[model samples]
Target: MRKLISESFFFCSFFSLFAAFSPMTIHAAVKVPVQQMGNKTVATAIGATRCLTPAMKSLHAQTVKQMEKDMAQVDAVVYAKAIETYQKKLSMIWSAMSEPYCGYGSRGMTAVKSSFNKSVNRMRAEFLAVTKTAPVAKK
Candidate 1:
């Protein structure tokens, strides 16, 4: 009985020490809820950016049509004002996704970070090409 008790105590201590020193269960101090929320927000924003591209093109076409129609009846100042408004809207839409913060404070999940960067770069380059080629009316 004495030997059994001694062996049980030794085993318990050894197991406890092993658990305490285990590499698989290291606890981090940071438990910020905002980090996860920020990830969700970033994902939604990126999704919105992707979803809005077609709508943006449609709106751009509609604006160009209106501008063409307005140019016929409006003086230079009025046409300039219309063009300025359109340009401002376009800038705002582009700027919305320019500072995407999907990673926020995170070192970021490797696969997600890679994919997000790829998508953002692809879209940015496409946008840059489009803007470069798309004619801007003089103010």
Candidate 2:
């Protein structure tokens, strides 16, 4: 019984030490607000050269590509109207991204990427709905 108790204690201690030093634990402790992170990402992407990071640059390129793909699936008129509406919503997110935060590190870039992905997804959904209901053009 004593040996079993000692083994259990050692197991617990090992796990406790591992958890304490884990990257996820450290990240959780220093968690920044999503809005702040995203703002830093956007600011870095569009801001002056000094503020830009490679991560933000990559994210900006990915976002542009995704937006273009989303816009390509619909008719020209539908694409134009949908893009206008999508841009309006994206502008609000861009405004949110203007807030101050930590530099555009991995976490901040991830948040920005997430926001862009969500925006694209919403735009795609809207385009699909509009196309489905729009009158078919007789070629």
Candidate 3:
């Protein structure tokens, strides 16, 4: 009985040491909460969005690329018309590269429009996933 107890105690001590020294699990912090993301979508999307007359083909390409990423974050249809107006400003600028211009400035702007849809859809999916998950899973 004495030998058996000592053996069990030794095993328990080894197990405890191993467990204490094991690699820890880490969790990443969420950047935005689901509840707040919807509110920020439009604001963040258009934050840096603007159009400038094409200085050169390269500059025009870069500016428009950044602006599209910004504008594609709108979450509602009410703002879509405003986006359309901003985008419309581009049409007048291209003919005169030296002239500064304003707006999203596209005739069709299909790519920005598509990215906007993609962002909204992805947000919806993420929100849905969070809503469907277990409310109280222990760490």
Candidate 4:
């Protein structure tokens, strides 16, 4: 009976130590709320745009010019592809930057995607607005 008690105590101690060092426990320490996740994505997006070099800005200008041309031709497919690619790239960058905070878990990813969709739609609209306002070069 004494030996059984000692073994049980040893098992309890081992399990307690394992639980203390578990990934779930560590993750909880750095947990970011879903609302804050959206804020972070917006901040990151703004920072990304602000950090763009003149060359990058020029490229964006060219893209806008091209988009204006596409619009004149009523190219729905081109708009779809451009927006999808832009969103995917932005999401990829945001995901890599946010992994530490949001985690590799499905729930965390869903939160990031949901909040990003809401926050990033404004940028999408701005892109469309810029293309509409900019003059299209003659083909």
In terms of lDDT, the best-performing candidate is 2
Clashes of each: 0, 1, 6, 0
Q: 8-60 in candidate 2: lDDT tens per residue?
A: 99999999999999999997787443325644732233233222356655665
What are the models' TM-scores?
Answer: 0.26, 0.41, 0.29, 0.28
Candidate 4 has its poorest 10 consecutive residues by lDDT at: 42-51
Pairs that collide in candidate 1 are none
| Of candidates 3 and 2, the better by TM-score | 2
Better of 2 and 3 by lDDT: 2
What lDDT tens digits, residue by residue, belong to model 3 across residues 57-114? Answer: 5555654665476566553353454455445554334433332332235643444344
- Evaluate residue 117 in candidate 3 and report its C-alpha lDDT on the 0 to 100 scale: 41
> Which candidate leads the pack in TM-score?
2
Instruction: Provide the lDDT at 39 for model 1.
Output: 39
CA lDDT of each candidate? 0.49, 0.62, 0.48, 0.53
Which lDDT value does model 1 have at 26? 55
What ranges in model 1 sit over 4 Å off? 1-48, 77-139
Superposed Cα deviation of residue 72, candidate 3 (Å): 1.5
Which candidate do you rate higher for TM-score, 1 or 3?
3
